[model samples]
Target: MADLSINFAGIKAPNPFWLASAPPTDKAYNVIRAFEAGWGGVVWKTLGEDPAPVNVSSRYSAHYGKNREVMGFNNIELITDRSLEINLREITQVKKDWPDRAMIVSMMYPCEEESWAKVLPLVEATGADAIELNFGCPHGMPERGMGAAVGQVPEYVEMVTRWCKKYCSLPVIVKLTPNITDVRLPARAALNGGADAVSLINTINSITSLDLDNMVARPIVGGRSTHGGYCGSAVKPIALNMVAEIARDPATHGLPISGIGGISNWRDAAEFIALGSGSVQVCTAAMLHGFRIVEQMKDGLSRWMDEKGYASIEDFRGKAVANTTDWKYLDMNYQVIAQIDQDKCIQCGRCYIACEDTSHQSISQLIADNGARKYEVIKEECVGCNLCEITCPVEHCITMVPQASDKPYMNWTQDPRNPRAVAA
Candidate 1:
């Protein structure tokens, strides 16, 4: 009922949900279907030079739950395998037909200004709204001195971003790799080099498993396997933390963010917005489900927004940022302890075992007045570490109860461990 329109880096999208550059946006055909399914936009799959060849079939493997929840997505796929000429032609046609949809092109190549200068004009010529430099692809291309190689170096991020700014008239969105010690460094570099926006986090380097039986892992070649970049719901926490870090960094304070990695539903999208992402991007979710999933996401997000009385997308975007603070600034008095409901407990002493072995020994098992084995939280020793809550099988069975007033402080407010902490 309310308007879902948003302007990302001066480009308009019907909503804040955009399909990330992946197989879904590998070509114009897929993007057209995605837009028809209610997706706001698509970042056309990463394109490279005139001729780029990637691996054959079986380049992808996924980890999923029985209920169909996509836990993780792994890819050895390289940049666009299509020729540059054809990709440009298709991009031109797609933008012409879907003028209202945001069309941001993702591209990667050698870390050369000439290479970028040569490519930018052609991409802009295709009438794309913006350009997202693909500096974060962790597999296949890194050995060629592209992708994550360029992304890992802050100086290279700055240099490459500056090249795009110099030649590419359209807004430049620098895609960041999460393989660094702290994401803030490269984020700062992108902003410093005049990037209009930044998108993250690219897949983390991971090796899912080893086939001990066959002595050859998946996506294997020559009886050995190399690590691939990982995506999907499993990486959501890592992506969120990195997004928050970039958003709060003073160096990249006002830069627009295109949030990527592990977005399946409207709730995840909303969380990214709260952490200061202007637009949310999806890839593996759509791959697992059909394009129709966008319908649910769009409707659900709209309904939730209406319920929250947000007249528009920007109304609630980043509202939670004001509440997020450095460790030293948090309130020290707030505290909560795990409270397990007897009815919800399955009589499994997992909570007690976990608490005793890895956490505070606050759980006590004793015979109840009714002569039943019962596990109770020792009010005196319970530190509210939350290990029990996490390992619980049932949801909402184990919850944390806030501490009483006049107790010892619970938070790390005025963190004595921080070097910047004011010496008392």
Candidate 2:
């Protein structure tokens, strides 16, 4: 059997699946239940300085797809609302009971050495495996000069992380915010400050819906709403690209990454590992489905590892990172054309309509030998854009087929089309 165990930034766990710091890991009750459900670890919900902020009612909003599936979720909730003393006591007991599982405490404070220095010892007493600097909460906390307010500034990221490293003895994982234009800047800053690892992304700044009738946004409390952190399935692509960017960057290469955002299944976790995540974190999925989801995540990953002839998670981890590259590195000489399978076609006309009306119009309506109206790709006009394939109803009915290329290798950087190429 393939081993699911992982040693992420020196914190060992039975598996790489850890509950992200959210409602799911907000307290001892939730963390204990998650452990019973087979999760490898939990990052205890973010703890802040004493006098925790009050939360408002109607704190959540969601974006739904055509079938009413949750595309994205948004929330304006603050960090752990419980007292710091109570939270530390619970974390201490939980860590003592679950010795084998990784317990990481997520913390935030004002950007001052005195504030961070004071809290580190209290949390360190919990015997938790690590501490994650919570710099990515994008809602209420930012307004108070905490959370994303600290994260958006690279200098503050480095300065605060340095304070944590200075005062805290445990491994420090910097949780990054994705609202910035370039995620790598903060990632590199974390590494510069002696962080043991990094996790991304906290959440995107988003408004999930609008109540046009009331002239307000969603999650309207007393006829008012504010932009909250957006998460869930819709943010997966954005999260994946950011992870890859940090993993592949020359300055931050070899930094341990705890991948979060939109991971719901074994495949999702596997993709994160392949893209160089040392471990994976989950929140929105657990919120939607329940703690039992980890069982399937563990079992499915093990099954896949067995089929792939792998011995452990490390054997396949970071395997896909090599293939991700810049657009300029792509083969300019490569060519492909879309092909339509006649037998599998249901004549949905979706492909034809999509191509003709909005796309390149590379697909044409024609009469087949059997006198049936057929949609076929116009070979000469097809740009291999795959828009038709994306809009097609039948899976595998339309595929991009690679054409044989006799031309030599060429790239835009050095090609004649490049106006910025330097003289060699």
Candidate 3:
């Protein structure tokens, strides 16, 4: 079996799967349970000053699919409502008990250096492996000039990260907010401030749905609703892109990354690792399923790695970064056409309908002598957009076959059609 262990920015874990800081890792009971279920680490839910923050009633809402599956999760909740003293005490005890598992504490405080200065020592004394600066909470705490408010400003990100680095001996992981226009700015700021690693993407600012009858957004509170942090499988693409951006950017390249947002399975975790995440974090998946899901994640990842002849996580980590390039660098001469397999096709006209109605008219409908409807791709008109393949219900029914080409590889930067093409 391939080794799943990782030493992510000095915080070692038996496996790369760690529970993100959320409701699941809010307390010692939860952290202990998660460790028992095979999770390699836990970023204890964000802690703050002594009083803690008051959470609102009806803290959660969900965006569901047709089958009533949660596609996205929304929460208007604040940081840990429990007192800081209680939290620190619990963390100290938990870390003492679970010495092998990674014990990372997530914290958010006012932008002031004093606030961070005051809390860093207390948390450091808890024996936690590292401290994650939670600069990414999208809703409640941002109103108090913390969370996303601080994350949105690059200057604040650099300043606070510096404070943590200055005041604490533990590794500093800057948790970045997705609410910003450009995620790389904050990532670069974290690097500039001497952060050991960066974790992302934090929840996005979103209102999942509305209560139509009550005339408010959800999760409703006293018939009124407010925007909340949105996360889950729906945000995976956004998170992957942001991670890639940071990994590929010259300014932030090689900065350790703990990939977060919408990771549910081993494949998702593997994708993040391939894109340069040293470790991957989970939250919504555990909430939807349970801690035991980490078992499946570890098993699947290990089996796949073994099949691919990988001996360890580092062997494949960041393997995809080089291929993840700008659109301008993509090959213009390469082409593939969608091919429909008649044997695999369930005679579902979804591909034909999607292509003919919305996309290019690249598929033709045919009526055979037996009165059976058949759909075939129009080789001439197909742009190889894969719309037909995407809409097809059956897996492997439509495959894009690359055409053999003798032409030299050419990109937009070298194409004659581009006015700004580099001089030959």
Query: Best candidate per TM-score, number?
Result: 3
Regions of model 2 farther than 4 Å from truth: 367-371, 422-424
Best by the lDDT measure: 3
Candidate 3 clashes: the total is: 0
- lDDT, candidate 3, equals 0.94
Q: Which digits, one per residue and each the tens of the lDDT, describe model 3 over residues 196-248?
A: 99999999999999878878999989888899999999999999999999999
- Alpha carbon lDDT of residue 241, candidate 3? 98
Regions of model 3 farther than 4 Å from truth? none
Sort the predicted structures by TM-score, highest score first.
3, 2, 1
Model 1 lDDT tens row, 1-424: 8688999899899998899988889998899999899889999999998667767566776666888555888888888999999999999999999999999999997988899888889999999999999899998888999999999999999999999999988999999999889888888999999999999999999876567888866666766777888999999999999999888877788789999989999999999998999999999889989788999998999999999898898898878777777875666667788898999998778898898888889999877799778788987888777888998898999999987788554445345665555533
Between candidates 1 and 2, name the one with more favorable TM-score: 2
Error of 3 at 141 (Å): 0.8
TM-score of each model, paired residue for residue: 0.93, 0.97, 0.99
Candidate that beats the other on lDDT, 1 or 3, i.e. the better one: 3
Model 2 TM-score on a 0 to 1 scale:
0.97
Evaluated at residue 2, the lDDT of candidate 2 is: 95
